[model samples]
Target: MRSPDQRLTSEAKVTAQSMLLDPSNASTNPVENWRACFPEIIGRSPAMIAALETAAKVARSDSSVLIMGESGSGKELFASAIHRLSHRSPQPYIPLNCAAIPENLLESELFGHERGAFTGADKRRIGKFEAASKGTLFLDEIGDMPLALQSKLLRVLQDKKFAPLGGNDLKEADVRVIAATHMNLEAAVQRKSFREDLFYRLNVLPVFVPSLRERSEDIPQMLEHFTEITNSNHSAPSVSFFTDAAIRMLCKYSWPGNVRQLQNLVERMVVLKGGGAISIDDIPSDIIRSIEGQKEQAIVSTGADFQPNFQQASSAMPLAIGGRKQIAIPDQFGVLPEAGIDLTSFIEGLENGLILQALERTNNNRNQAAKLLGLNRTTLVERIKKRRLAVLNEPSKEL
Candidate 1:
């Protein structure tokens, strides 16, 4: 019998071949062929799968799409996928970062400029809108777009037409607009920094990409994917495997920089280790310290009889998720009753408080809260249900 790894690889190859045979499978249900077509976008988490499905559905329409996610969470990848899967795939897919470009040049960059429009305008320049006509224009970091530019953008979206700088003729825009931002546009709108009209115009179809911590279960796969990429790009030797302890430590890390951070770490590891097996020592010291801190906190919070046998536990439980080993203890305790204390009620209340705090830190985003508490979404929900705590602004209880 083939080993599990070999079997998995064989199955993946078969699936890829089948997808190639039926090209229509991608258009009809792109999510089904997500791994085959979008290898750069990696995640098997329910949160990610849902976001991709929504993107695929919206890709069929020409309506605007607003992608919300933390920095380095691959918003551009989703935007590109939408453009590629859309009817305008034959046309250009232009991307311009509103934050990267200067405010003065941004207007001309989006609306073009005629000769002698400004000091640097030596000749007629085609802006993003004109260049992306009949295609897609991805406005990344749209929240950082100047208020003046937002008005012009709103006009273009509204009328499907725009005039170049220092030009009288109005050019028709047949392009779809896909805006992405790491900022909270709603908050920006409330603060009068981002235009309200522009926010509504871009938010026709919103797709929220969950942060890396929200989908830590996919870390192993992502590490492998990045490893392969690093090897192929640098022509390094193939990485055999990552030690289970190393994988667990990585999975438990709070990736503040999201997917991009993980990719960078993987590249560094491949180069440093020369594509050999990655052991726990090979991981960065900060990551190791973070994992250790979390483990220590978990033990202290539970108040359970904890032993420092992590290495033995890791070796024994090679597949333990998040590097945590659960030890069950009998519910026996010495009771001192001057005034009777309800231990059950106190413990329950403490648990509820922690859950609420986690929810608050994550802005009531359950997936993120679950990660914060080191529990899966289902377990988190069950805890919430048991405690009967009211959570406001709970974004779509699904996953």
Candidate 2:
């Protein structure tokens, strides 16, 4: 049958697929109906599921939707999904980037200009508002629109009518607006850069898309999706898969650039390292440095904080220590001080406190105390003997 190399390759492929497609048990997991609406959106993390649920609910309405997210987090995909699920799915889905056009031409871009209206205007033109009639107009980077343009946009949203530049006739507008911005519009309003009234108008129904770092669980599936798309579109031999170690390192990455960065990495690998499984060595040097740097930083920080942090961590255990001055723990206590602690005394005190609390709760029943502390009865007895702890009674014997 198959050669040993071929069999190994098949097994690796299966393992990669399993790793990428593990089922999630999150309560907000997207159902089949909702998933069907967003076939292009490639994530099943709880954060993604919650966002999908929100988009599905808001899709039925014709109200303005303001999508807030970090750049490259796929705000446009959500906008398209909402339009697809809405009643206006049959109509044109027009999109315009507010930040891309110049200030002088932006007004004309939103609400067409008449022939000879401006120096460059040669013929009559329809803007996004008129072009997106009875459909959805996705305004990307709406936060960057100039103040003058913002006022005109607010008027159109309120009155549903606008006069073409150099034309007096008011044109009736019937368009559903879906705006997306990575900026905090409230902060912009506070700065008096963005119009407060326009912000509220667009924010009637708000949707937030989580960043790649927040939905790290979805990275494997996303990596797989990007790989498949890259292989299919490119003319080179297929970049088949990645090694398990490589995938683990990728998951640990913070992904500051989010999905776009991940996709670019996959495409770069396909072009440079196609035709085989990509090992950890295949990953870019900068990414490896970043992951390693985070690990080192975590280790150093945790080690410095471990003693006091251990106290707080152990406090979360089932049994609370008894009969001590209940002083509030301060934030500064989490850090290691210059004086440092007596390790032996600190450990013994913490252990004794827990044991004493457990024994008190169980009324000096050795077996019960052992159970509470998740220790063997024999082990608990040895500890008590070594510590010379005084037990008042042994009424309940071991079963």
Candidate 3:
């Protein structure tokens, strides 16, 4: 017979194996057919995997779900996945953006309106709730919904019935609610901007989508996905693969706009570069500057070599400014050399370089150029005047 400790150890090992083998653990048991399961969502980070697992579990039920994440973090995709995984997949999955519609017409949009309900109501129309009676109703930017509408929404949730605008009889609805928002509903409730009761109702099954910055490891996969999309959409100019250095720079970027920004960048590059391999030169100057800034901060923090890694990684890389080779300021023992760097001059040079690049990219369209440089048109004009950049001071043209 085995000793008590040995038997307990064997039992623990069996339990561990069982947990590892569980299909719900996305990290260990990868979903063999993710395309069919989560067609729009893509990522392999621990946070993303955990979120997908939670979404899958919650999809089995008809409970209301509130998805929270940064803007462009793919909350709608999660909402759609939940609907697809649920029993109501065959039914219509209607989506409505609460913030996009005007406050005056939001009620009519949600519950629909009858003929002669209002001055502009020439004919009767069904609302999202009625349209998605047996399916799902995805409410994007739910926190931006007006306080007055929150009460009506709460009533519908409580009774599972609603009346169309200016209607007398109550209509039944069997729709599942999946709301998404980048705003903090709890804070909104505390501020009285959002109803506390309504917040509780919508947040029954909260699923937080991780931002792209949080899952930097997924950048390469996302790049590939976007590239494929770009290629499929256009002919003649096929998508090009990013160089290793370029990929590293992209992975290091803090994507404030999340996946949407990355997708835009990919499409822009694919359109501009035709079919060659994407190098550091293909990247936007703003993005390159941001990456270099991050590297500078890291070097300062670690008191390491001040020389940027990119310089060594791609010696032939063209500088953003007039194709001049980037100046290397050597440091000794974590200290500035006797010939200390001119900080103001360096900043001005960087700014001038970015402005010139933006002007060239936009074909001398001042407004568009200013937007690319994240400056007001007037400010850009003023800078051009200050720097005596006569080339940029030509007649302005709107794009």
User: lDDT of candidate 1?
Assistant: 0.71
What lDDT does each candidate get? 0.71, 0.72, 0.72
Identify the runs in model 1 with alpha carbons over 4 angstroms from their true place.
1-39, 237-240, 298-399
Q: Which predicted model would earn the best TM-score?
A: 1
Query: Please, what are the lDDT tens digits per residue for candidate 3 over residues 219-308?
Result: 999998998788778774555778898888899876657788899999999878887688888999877876676567522111111322
Candidate 1: which pairs clash? none
Q: Per-residue lDDT for 46-152 in model 1, tens only?
A: 77887776776687788999988767778988888777667776688889999999999999999999999989789999999999989889999898899988999
Candidate 3 has which clashing residue pairs, if any? Answer: none
Tens digit of per-residue lDDT, candidate 2, span 1-399? 111122224443333223223434222434543454466688888888888878877877889999977667789888877776677766878889998998998888888989999898999998888888888899999989999889989999999998888789998989999999876565466468899899999989888888786789999999899988888887776556777888889998867566888999999987688668988999999788767765665221111122222222221222223444433222223343223333443455457667766777777788999999999999998776544453324344545
> Which sections of candidate 2 miss by over 4 Å?
1-30, 298-399
TM-scores of the models, in the order given: 0.69, 0.68, 0.67
Please say which candidate is ahead in lDDT: 1 or 2.
2
